[model samples]
Target: MKPLLLLDVDGVLNPMSRPTPDFHRYRCTVGAEVYTVHLNPRHGRRLIDLALATGSELVWATTWEEHANEWIAPRIGLPSLPVIPMRPGEPSEHGEMFKTRHVADYVGGRPFVWFDDQVWAEDEEYLRVHQGLADFLLIHVDPGRGLTSRHLGMAHEWLTLTGFSQGS
Candidate 1:
């Protein structure tokens, strides 16, 4: 089975600190709030290239959920990817991200790389002790810079060292 690449939207792809988006900027209103995401076309290519190179199946693990496919993916030039179903809200422990608890359920023992700005040490500890995952990379990206070639390079190296062969 192909390894999983769990992607987050806000920080990894749409850097919150980038004032001027290099690609198209989109705005939408959800209930009482207006949300805008700045996307770089290069990031689209880079992410697509990463998947092709590693043969990892990209899955959306953001609050954006299915909306990622409907809205964010198109703007970022990615085709529809599976969205990790949101677990009903959980109160987080200090230093624990809300998403940590659901990861193992979705991963189902498959090796995975989770890219998110919100990853914390507690999440890693929890996974190490509880998840029984054979291989995983919890990549923490800075929201200020989003993802860079350096991050992709690290991913390539991790997969190489872990002996994760491409499936497709």
Candidate 2:
């Protein structure tokens, strides 16, 4: 089975800083409110490169919704990747869990690694229960720095263990 790399935009590819000129700017509306976002295109490119090299299918698991392809993909150099849209009618409070389930469904029988900052114990519990025999790698990004060298190292290790890649 092909392995999947579930990518989250905000804190993973795009650091949630106020302003960063090098990053791609985005705006979204949540019901009555509008918000702006900045995506670190350089880091996004780096992550995309890793995804391509490892032969892992890339799926968008962010609140960007369907806009991930039009707004996020071209900026990051991945235009043709398939996006896993957030679950319909999912409550905003449990968006993280919704994303997790969407990712699981997208990958189907394949192994997967989910990179996100908002994941909690609930998400982990859900994965533990529904993952069945396929390996589910949950990579939690830190608040301030997103994914660090240590985080990547850990992901690399997990990828190796799951036979997604041959570790260096």
Candidate 3:
């Protein structure tokens, strides 16, 4: 099986720190409330292409949940992808990321590369010590800059080295 690409939205694709006209601003109503998301189109294409190149399954690992498919997917030109479910009011201990626990459960021993702006050393340590069946890569994207070409290059290098392809 291919490795999983766990993607977060706000900082990785949206670059929440920077506000510019280049980003698409949209309002979406998931249930009772309307939420606005800022998305960068280029980031979508870059991620999609990277998934194809790496022979990985792209999965939504964001807090946006299914709303990522409804609001952000079309704007970024990505199809509906499986989402990593986050339980309502999930509690996290100190030094742990909000999504880290759910992510660990969702991956379930599958090799995965997680892209997020909020990854910490504790998150890495947690995965390293607890994960036994699969290799894991935690890529921390800068919220101010979002994802760059260098990040894609690094991901490609890792996937290539991990042997997840018919051939390069």
Each prediction's TM-score versus the true structure: 0.90, 0.77, 0.88
Task: Show where candidate 1 strays beyond 4 Å.
Answer: 19-21
Candidate 3 per-residue C-alpha lDDT over 1-168 given as tens digits, one digit per residue, 9 for 90 to 100: 788888888888878675567787778787899877778787778878888888888899998899889888889889999999987566666577868888888888678888899998988877776755478888999988777788788888888898864225
Which pairs clash inside model 3? none
How are the candidates ranked when ordered by TM-score, highest leading? 1, 3, 2
List RMSD in Å for every model shown.
2.0, 3.6, 2.0
Show the lowest summed lDDT stretch of 10 residues, model 2. 87-96
Give each model's clash number.
Answer: 0, 0, 0
The total of clashing pairs for model 3 equals 0
Model 3: lowest-lDDT 10 consecutive positions? 159-168
Residue-by-residue lDDT tens digits, candidate 2, 49-112: 6666666667777777667777677766776567787766675343346676776666777777
- Alpha-carbon runs more than 4 Å astray in model 3: 131-133, 165-167
> Which lDDT values do the candidates have, in the order given?
0.81, 0.69, 0.82
Candidate 2 ranges beyond 4 A from true positions: 19-34, 88-96, 131-133, 166-168
List clashing residue pairs in candidate 2. Answer: none
For TM-score, the strongest prediction is: 1
